[model samples]
Target: METTTATPWLTEEQQRIWRSFLGGTTVLMDRLDRDLRAAHGLSMPEYEILVRLSEAPGRSIRMAELADAVAHSRSRVTHTIARLERENIVVRGQCSEDGRGVSAVLTDHGFSVLEAAAHTHVQGVHDYLIENADAQDFIAMGRIMQNVVEQLHGKNF
Candidate 1:
């Protein structure tokens, strides 16, 4: 009998772990988004954008760069910036060096909102994820995620 050259699919245990990771990540992010939205009116993506901008130089970054850092599409970033601009939380400024380039700057009010939301967000993370998880488990999770993210996104994004 001829044997197959191609490798077979995941073993049952491998499948179980992979599926658990997928489903758990989905649920965790969903819960986080919901909690942040209810408590702070900020989506997870928006919160990430704010955090990145807050830590960047002058509390601002070019629009395209911001999108890259957040792993969002340029168009999606624009839409998000528009919404934030409307809320007066973030401001868009023309890049003096490049007229076509725009920068998203987090306003003082935006910083305030982020600071306030951070407390609730952290508590939510602690309640939903950290409180139930062991330190070793948490570290393992980070390492696993780091490996996955590096493998998947390091080259492309």
Candidate 2:
């Protein structure tokens, strides 16, 4: 004889937490994007790309690596890099190891731009998430998010 298991539904408390996470994340991201735009004339995605490039070795990374780092599609990364290139913030070069691979190098201007924008982004994060959250709760949230990321992304990455 075989037994069938029933699907479990979320409890009210679980549902509440899930909804709050969704809404809060949306609002937080929107606020951060708006703050970055108003302060530095950079969109959040562009800022993220610059940040990743700046942190990479030699202030450069392969376009595919950048897309993976930022969780964006290759096509989207290409478009954003093109926009940054036009602004003289970043330039693409043939990857030394593999000529077919493309690398995005952050220009001095790009580093300066990221430096100027970092403050606004940090403060927005603090204002929207950190300052408002309890210290213990925030740590717990971090752990929970790490678990989620590991469960969802660890295998693929």
Best by TM-score: 2
Candidate 1, poorest ten consecutive residues by summed lDDT: 148-157
Each model's C-alpha lDDT? 0.91, 0.93
Give the lDDT of residue 132 in candidate 1.
76
Q: List the residue pairs that clash in candidate 1.
A: none
Please provide, for model 1 over 1-157, each residue's C-alpha lDDT reduced to its tens digit, 9 standing for 90 to 100.
9977898789999999999888988998999899889988999999999999899989999998998888888999999999999998899988888979999999999999999888878888988889978999999989988897778763664
The TM-score, computed over Cα atoms with residue i paired to residue i, of candidate 1 is 0.89
lDDT of 1: 0.91
Error of 2 at 115 (Å): 0.5
TM-score for each of the candidates? 0.89, 0.93
At residue 111, give the lDDT of candidate 1.
97
Tens digits of per-residue lDDT for model 2, 1-157: 8788889899999999899989998998999999999998899999999999999999999999999888888899999999999999999988987878999999999999999999999988888899999999999999998898778762565
